[model samples]
Target: MKRRVAITGVGLIDPLNESINNFFARTIRGESSIRYFASKGDPVPVSIPAVYCADFKGDDLLGKHRTISMDRFSQMGLVAAFDAWTNAGFNVHDRSHKPNAGVSWGTALGGTRIYEQGLREMWINGRERLPPLSVVMGMNNACSSHIAIQLGLGNSSLTYSVACSSASAAIGEAYKRIRNGEANIMVTGGSDTPLIYGVIRAWDGMRVLSPGNEENSPSACRPFDKSRSGLVLGEGAAALVLEDWDHAILRGARILAELAGYGANCDHVNLVKPDSSGQAAAISLALEDAGIPPKDVGYVNAHGTATIEGDPSEIEALRSVFGRQAKELAVSSTKSTHGHLMGASGAVEAVITVLCLKNSIVPPTANLKDIDTSCEGVRHIRIGDSNKSDLKAAISNSFAFGGSNAVLVFKST
Candidate 1:
């Protein structure tokens, strides 16, 4: 028999809020966190509106000693992971429980801020100045490494870097590990702090970052709307504590929801553009893994980045998977409010999906005033929140730039 996985605890550090309850409450209120930031002597021509964790003080959460060696991204991960560890009722200082736990973190453009700072120091200062811990802090695996060391997880520590799908992939792999009995518990999530000057400039060159209307900066990310422009970059982290169902039951843990299935695939098409067929296959595969039929999914947390191409591609994929019933599914994209968190999008959205299942309230697609005709058929939860107490299962979709697609199925417990 396959071991079941239960989501016992969740942690979030985002532009909207840090705690799960606060984040969900703010999200359901249809508020957007995107704001304008003036360029700091960068080559970028204009200021852009982006989502940022304004009040996050890593030093306050991790302490001066622990924060000294970590970059902003890693610090966010450590803080979120710590929140999850405590929420799960585990003693972080107890080394005896460490052997049974592990960490799987996902990130895209890890520690880019440190790299950018290093480059500035070398080029502008005309000196070979660099931080002593720069190499370690700039590594892609640094967040996972720090999480493992800080939490004393000894079973395994892995980091995934699959563009936007990174976090979902990490969580899926963690679920498999628990199911295969490799570990009893896994702390899984993703983090990315990509709002720095260099990263934003690079993204701006790609023409994917939203060019906000000077009048209304917060309403820039208009996902599924006819006037949708592009995604607004955001930075944050979210973590989930996944435990074997039997172990959780024996320990009398309260189960938030069950991670029932996971599916991952690639488009094999474009480097940046998404393919409907590839996304459809991943959704179908996830349903198959969960032994669920298409009609049973009451909600879909779409990977709607508000890009002209992305929104249509995702809708097309949903149409393929649900067929005529696609029109009946309640779908929305929280990215409309939170902005895109790059690698951390999947993990943060997963937490939101679980909260929706637990609370029976679906967050709206903010700024979706006029739905694009292409996305018309789907029953999108737009503008305001919707209450659906009978929702049984929901799927969170994450399709990355490299054609990597990951789908996760969550069932109400």
Candidate 2:
């Protein structure tokens, strides 16, 4: 109960791969999933394209409501979780364990696709009329609930809806549960499908999204760069099998990485913009939790959304927390290649950080023509391709729309 937690298995379904192993292998080869193709027909201005999971048909992975009603985001979470559980070599209902298995899914906006669709049907059909599956499918917790039901995970099943940091927070909470003797295993992650027109329109209202970037599609996300304009939206889901370190070893499970510490802070200052001081505090708190010095951190997976306010604020946050070490740190944003997956951003990027440690490499920032003079001293890997090396420890930051900041520190297993 006093020790650490380890990632036993991880499954990802995004623009990169339908499976986790495939995604990591491809990433090591310096591949990207960003594309300019449009789903609605006509030449739509799409930038910061991401690796997106393809469509799913009726299947057991979709569970009981396979043919009925479900959103793309929830469906993807289920599929990814299915693979994650199998990869971890455990089943939710196995009599070998009790109360040890749990489910926690996070999302910024859950099942918006289902929500908008149901709303349209209701407006067209009237309250007297009905869409049979509206109630169960459109709810914000639907994704978590569905997976819980199919897996028989009982009351421990829950959802955290904290925008971009949602997934990392979910992972952090699960880590605590396992370490405190509450549970032995938990499946935690996030899902989102914001590529839909309705979803895009919601983000566009904030005026932080890119209109278009014709020349740099994959590299449209120029994090911490002077040429950085704004963030490009992307979507996907990722799930991790988190288990107690000893239990995973006893079960002969493969360890991906060790989750040493996690810290979450809220600005409570603004609804949209983050408080840089608050964000900096989160990282310092995480480092304290890990019992490690800031200089020991080898790399940082920055939030780096490339927004007008986000990049500089985070850079300053780093400077406040790590001081001179922040200047020499190898920081990069995967958002440049994958775009921001909203709810799933933190979870998926956490997986990326772990794998980068396991594989002894760092994925490139994708697009960095000119560095911002303000961020000059901070070491951001401005290369356009993957670079290989031994990574000892890494920090991942995810800041969301509601001024929620989540930071996690991972060490080699």
Candidate 3:
């Protein structure tokens, strides 16, 4: 028999350092953390419109000794994971082993900051070597390994690096593990820090980074708007604790929502361009997996990155899947306020979706005033709009550059 998966806890490390509650409140209120960010202590600094946690002092939070061996990405991941674990009522001080519990994390550019720093030290400062434990800290799996070790999760420690879909894919797989009865609990989510010089230069070359002056930076990411430019890279982490329904009930845990379905598919059409058919297929698969009719889904946390093509493609896909009901389905992209967290976007958005269901409030796409003609059909939730409908289910989408599409379905418990 297939076991049911429940979301017992959720946490996030956003640019504003807001707790999960504050984040949701501000998000639905259309507040933005995006700003004009400039790199420091580098010969060729990068200045871009982005969302960054300027107050995140790793050493102060994680302790200087514990953080000495970790990269910024791993530090954020561990903090987010630990927050989720504790929120789930798990004892962080308990070092006891749990064979049925595990961790599945995701990151696209894990430890890139460390590598960039090392290269800078070698080339500019004439240093022959990097810091100690650089290799262990720079590995993509380092975050997952650290979470498992710190939490004493022994069932499995896995990581996925599928660009934007990384987190959703990781969450989906963890849900599958619990649903398949292979595990009783799983701590799953994703983290990414893409503000390094190299990463920025690469994206700048692609001409996909949003442009904004100091006055306009906060509204840079206007998804589904006619004046939309491009995506703004953000750095942070988010985590969710997925537990077996029976196990959570036995422990008297507070279940937040049900991770009902996960659908992942590849477009195979283009590397950068999105295909509506493939996206629709994935959404259809997720609804089928959850045994939920399209009409039952009241809201969608769209993967609307405000790109020239991505925004419209996602709307078309939703219309194809939901048909006439798509016209009434409330849809929004929280990326407008949080910016794009890249690999961690899915987890962050998933956490927001869970909160939306819990509070019965659907957040709007911030800074979206004029809707683009090509992105019509759905009930677009604009900034400051109050949506207190009895939302039964919601979908969060994560479509990546490599044609990877991951859709997660959640329902009120």
**TM-score list, all predictions:** 0.97, 0.91, 0.98
Model 3 per-residue lDDT at 49:
92
In terms of lDDT, model 1 sits at 0.90
Query: Clashing pairs in model 1?
Result: none
lDDT of each: 0.90, 0.78, 0.93
Which lDDT tens digits does candidate 2 get at residues 30-135?
Answer: 4556666354531354333544555544255565546366667778888778778877787745644535678888888887777666665676557555566766
- Predicted candidate 3 versus true structure: per-residue lDDT over 144-228, tens digit per residue: 9989988999999999999999999999999999999999999999999999888998999999999988898999999999999
From the highest lDDT down, the ranking of the candidates is 3, 1, 2
Give me the candidate number with maximum lDDT: 3
In model 1, the runs with Cα more than 4 Å from the true position are 16-18, 41-46
Query: Distance from true position, residue 119, model 1, in Å?
Result: 0.4
Candidate 1 lDDT over residue span 146-260, tens digit each = 9999889999999999999999999999999998899999999999999888788789999888887557889999999999999988899999999999999999998999999
- On TM-score, the candidate that comes out on top is 3
The ten-residue window of minimal lDDT in model 3 covers: 89-98
Where model 2 places Cα greater than 4 Å from the true spot, the runs are 28-30, 37-51, 55-69, 91-95, 124-128, 213-216, 384-386
Of the two candidates 1 and 3, the one with more favorable TM-score, higher being better, is 3
Count of clashing pairs, candidate 2: 2
